[model samples]
Target: MSDFRSQLQEKLGLSSVDYHSNLSKEALFQEALTYDKGRIREGGPDDEHKAYQTRLGVQGPLVFYTDPSCTGRPVKDTFAAAWPEFEDKIWWKPDFQKYDPEAYLGLRKRVVEHLNAKNARLYVQEVYCGVDPEYAIPVRFVGEYASHALFTHNMFPKDVEGVRDEDEKRWTILNVPSFHCEPERDGSKSERAVILDFKDKVVLICGRADYCGVNKKSMFTVFNYLLPEQQELSMHCSANVGKQNDCAILFGLSGTGKTTLSADPNRRLIGDDEHAWTKDGVFNLEDGCYAKLIDLNKEAEPVIAAALSMPGTLIENVPALPGKPLEETDPQDLDLTDRSITENTRFSYPLSANPNVMPGARGPHPQTIVLLTADAFGVLPPVSILTRREVMYHFVSGFTSKLAGTEVGITEPVAAFSACFGAPFMAHFPSVYAKLLAEKMEAHHTRCILLNTGWSGGPYGTGKRISIKHTRALLDAALRGDFDEGNVEYEKHPIFGLLMPKSCEGVPSEILNPRNTWEDKDAYDRQALKLKEMFHENFAKKGFGAFGIEDVMA
Candidate 1:
């Protein structure tokens, strides 16, 4: 404790500011109830002394709302310092821009000065980003609000052993919701900015954007940058293992069924999001799950729904039931259908809350790799097998429809392509991850397939949603090797160049080939051609061929 202040002063210029270190969840709950700001009218009676009861025993759920301007990730406001040292290493996505190195240095100092002058009470939490001791990075989070600290506690690993030099190489997150940035002076796009200073190993969340995802995804960007250098593949995907010890990985962006499908009653979950594929196998980067809470069906996604009642869970941006006071209403009673708040409403809970999980948050080499896409256009086949190059092609393409109600201002499903399915968080070039994926798939002799869990006969409004019953049937058949070459006959997708099965045992054969189900084959061809054009255009713009991935459509 004696040198703790000096250490902060050395790295962060943080001193004379009182801070608590590694506080437990119980203590943090008390601190949030007392000190955290941005509480809404629905917030329970503003009393910190009372011990509330939850289903897990005794802790009231913590609900928080961010600034109306920052209900979702202020993607445009995010930046990375273009220091000459490592600027070339970053991919610099369309949404994640570069900040001047000189201006970034000045802005960071101003934030520390603001924290000291106000004598703001701070909380520090020490945790690791990944589960593997050999590569997990140690992270130190220093923030004014205990709620953010508790979020740090929920979303990352703690007490990890065998990490190479755990304390020496630290990534510090400077979270200050109170310090506003001046665009002209601080070189920020807005009053709030999430800046990553790779050279100094620092992440600054300045001003009023306190979205909890900012804390998680910022570190995810760091992991994506660091892991690839060691030859590990960092992914935005979900994984689970079946009874025969067969492990499968599903890659997709949010709302594309990665979480929903991977939580199969027949399989044990490895992790829901953010993982690393290394020489040994795959391991989870986070110790918790931050799942979407909008329109969540209790029967379909019982694991996440049941987690709402657990102690120490944080529900963000979900509004209370209509005409009911939040304090008196049970957590379950909060309206899930109401997009009155942001559709990105989320729930943060420790993995311990889940009943079925991989023993060590790690699994063996995947036997099956599934690329999930919600094709609102309804032109793609329901299931198609992929070769190694096809996997690389689609992996880099990362196409899915950005569903309406999932983001602020987005009123309908629009074609969305995020490289590696999460371009914003990928620090290096898309090929860095794609090349590594190809290597891993080859080394393990893995089977790859693309599955579309979107509309069937027509586009979203015109066609019916593909039945989950059928999607599950196809998924189960693939896992059991029913689609192997000898098991089922295959036909080529003329436009996309994918090998899709002609039939499956449980699924209707008509739906197997998407065009057959449509009333007008010509219309289906046009839509299919339009989607293929999208893939080709995105491919040409990115110039992925330079990275050794060729287009299947070509």
Candidate 2:
């Protein structure tokens, strides 16, 4: 205990009395069991007894609450007596628990060090829940040397404090609310999350969720904790605001060239994952970029390669041989099944990677809002400028592919319309972000454009994927305002929503429609109907039946 106290005091930069008086070491471990029990109850208390009996029959109730506040509870008493079940659930596998405690403590120390360096206040709290309807956990702590309580919650204390009220602070916070549920064998749980940002005395809640199914609950919670606040001018998908005058907002889902396209050397990067566009200008949500580090080819993404080689960048799940050179290893040959290494790679870079970017990673109101889509079906044109109404329509449409290996069967091209391109992460509802975006764009006089970076000549399996280089060229031309200068005529198609001509010079026109691209018109029609039907089914599952393909099919 003395050693622990010394360590805590040293890491927190607090006197021994300060450390002991507020959230002592004894409290942290003593609170752990109660916290675990609360998690079990909140996760699925109804199944608690049944699961307990199935795993360990007649061994009292299968759940328990160690918090003194939860005394006299039937479920808690029963589970407390059935200590074996609690032990079984709480114990991490030996291998899983084999991580170096020193390393873990080092991480905590590093976080404290960073916060202290910034002169930020710190608050620590412990939360515990019971398996009941009235499960309310109260977390309390003192704001040592805090100038103002910047953020607060019942379950956690102030996240960032001790900063001046008028310091031009830019930070984001996310809150995931507790929903009704109980414990599981795998130790997974659900919660509702929201992202908030506080800047210039205004609060913006970016995403919210209401009963969006159990699979997405954890994702929402994680999303909230990742950002500073829900209102902190952040969007769910990848976004990069150019630093130059007349800069535009680049938006795209996971794989649609959002990071690759936006990390242009000529344009400054505000952020790669999330950002907020206000009347004043655009504000970056993060200090780094969470880039997808899959199949990374230096020739394709040189800046990203350089970023990976730099410091302050955290690489998750990438295979690197100890004492071996990084150049000799081919990222593509790494194991694809390891998500930590293959799929979920993040790259953090300073906002000043590009010189033309706005200083302090801020930008004026977007001159253009470019929505990127990876149309696996090679039929859509490379680019199409849209009116405000059209932008709103497409914003709600939110079309994109499911990426390779995400779904079985139909691994080929398919149409998926998720509202705001982030239906799953939204906290309040589907139209919340879309409506806000429409309002913001209108107020800022921003135009909307859609760019397709997928197959252009045929269906997914048969057609050659569009050349990334050509897509880059087209994007560069658009950013330079070249297309707006040219008097190009758009041809409406029967199945696709819009089509731009090949005579536009930089873009190939043959991909204007699927029917024209495919050799067999019958096959094209069949594929089109199949995709349309799939869209209809997906929308139906979400209780949205108003959207119909025939209405847009020219």
Candidate 3:
């Protein structure tokens, strides 16, 4: 064992340790099932292991349950140590809470002590963040739960060429879900905390919340902060390539179809959730894709649905059918409609899960840049071409409608504006990313489009969500150069100034204009005006005055 690993084990009082550093996927899967962290719940009715009950580890193939109180991310309890040099660089806010440097050490000491008290076996997994070795950072996931370590293996690049086994230039995260903190002494907001120290390049913490996403997202936060410094724009988006190597990227927040739209079997997927765009093109930040599993349908999302049955795919918080034997609980049999555990039920698997993925998760410069929005107001057109100014406006505005019950007490479609489509993960100023995107698009002559995968006829309560079939058809048309083929005429929307196409190949000519799709044209006008006002308010609040594209809103 290396000195660093030894010191960490000694510090945490680990009675036994398995250093599964850079293990193959098969070996890691075996260790994960052996460690009793999760179940291998079969996917098909007649697949092997029909007698395998849902007990986990030594117990059986049972589901790992977490406390209901801590289902989602505990942002309030998360913090970043305020080292002197990084204080000015960080965009300090609710999500990026600043912690006292000395106080953080005190917290770490307590965390280490808490781990030592467990006196259990620990698993350590080493992985890489970037697909491009030149920019990739060596990452280590040290945790008490073997499943999370296995997840780390699945979610990040493994077998990176340049990184040696004992290389010390790495970021190490110690994830102990059982460890708790005292707000009074540890300078925390709750028992759960995710603290990042950039100077030391370490993420310390505890998450009894047991939402494994914290483990992946926390590292993404680190990358979001670091990548911009190198002139690479870190984005919360998905990318894919075509037969002619025509690359495209989709940017959106939660509830938007960033993942669903990008998982095109007709095209090669580069990455699903996060990526970094550079001069050489785009490189995936993760080796795997983390897809939401709520109401997942086999026909609508065939690629994602097919991946669920594959070995090594980790399903979190999906409930088994009531009264069914655990052994007979196939993945297909689980109730995706049941969100009693979490609406955030997720599937984590390596890019290998999808047959049509870019090798090393890297692709060439994109020919199209898509900004996906779930506009519940039903005002935005299903598809619209964006100018450079409009692109800047929408990119910074990052507008989307929040679905009811996606969070606590949210029962209606609430308009949300997250700058760059990922404000929480963005570390630098919004302009840093916006400027980079504009420069790249201009340089590459990329076509930009605004796609609304939300409601169409009226607001959420009155109208239905835009059909996935239509959205897919529209996206395919745009990717195949149909939009720019010069046969279609464009008209400007009065409020948003986006150029709406008058006709599309597979879509109805009437639905191309959102106003025509509504029976109540006057009501649509009023709602459009209301949504326009929200956009204006958001632009003013974000201080996009410096961007000089404020006139696009007029």
Candidate with top TM-score is 1
Worst 10 residues of 1 by lDDT: 45-54
- Report the C-alpha lDDT of model 2 over 24-69, residue by residue, as the tens digit: 3223322321232222233343221111111111211111211122
lDDT of 1 by residue, 275-354 (tens): 99999898999999998888989887777888887778788878766776556777887788888768788888998877
Rank by lDDT, highest first.
1, 3, 2
Query: What residue pairs clash in candidate 3, if any at all?
Result: 36-57, 54-61, 54-62, 55-60, 55-61, 55-62, 56-60, 56-62
Report backbone clashes per prediction.
0, 35, 8
lDDT scores of the candidates, listed in order:
0.85, 0.42, 0.78
Q: Name model 1 segments beyond 4 Å from true.
A: 1-3, 39-58, 322-324, 403-413
Ranking by TM-score: 1, 3, 2
Residue 29, candidate 3: C-alpha displacement in angstroms: 5.5
What's the TM-score of every candidate structure?
0.94, 0.57, 0.88
Question: By the TM-score metric, which is better: model 1 or model 2?
Answer: 1
* Segments of candidate 2 deviating more than 4 angstroms: 1-233, 237-244, 320-342, 349-357, 403-411, 414-417, 480-486, 499-502, 544-554
TM-score of candidate 3 versus the correct structure, residues matched by position: 0.88
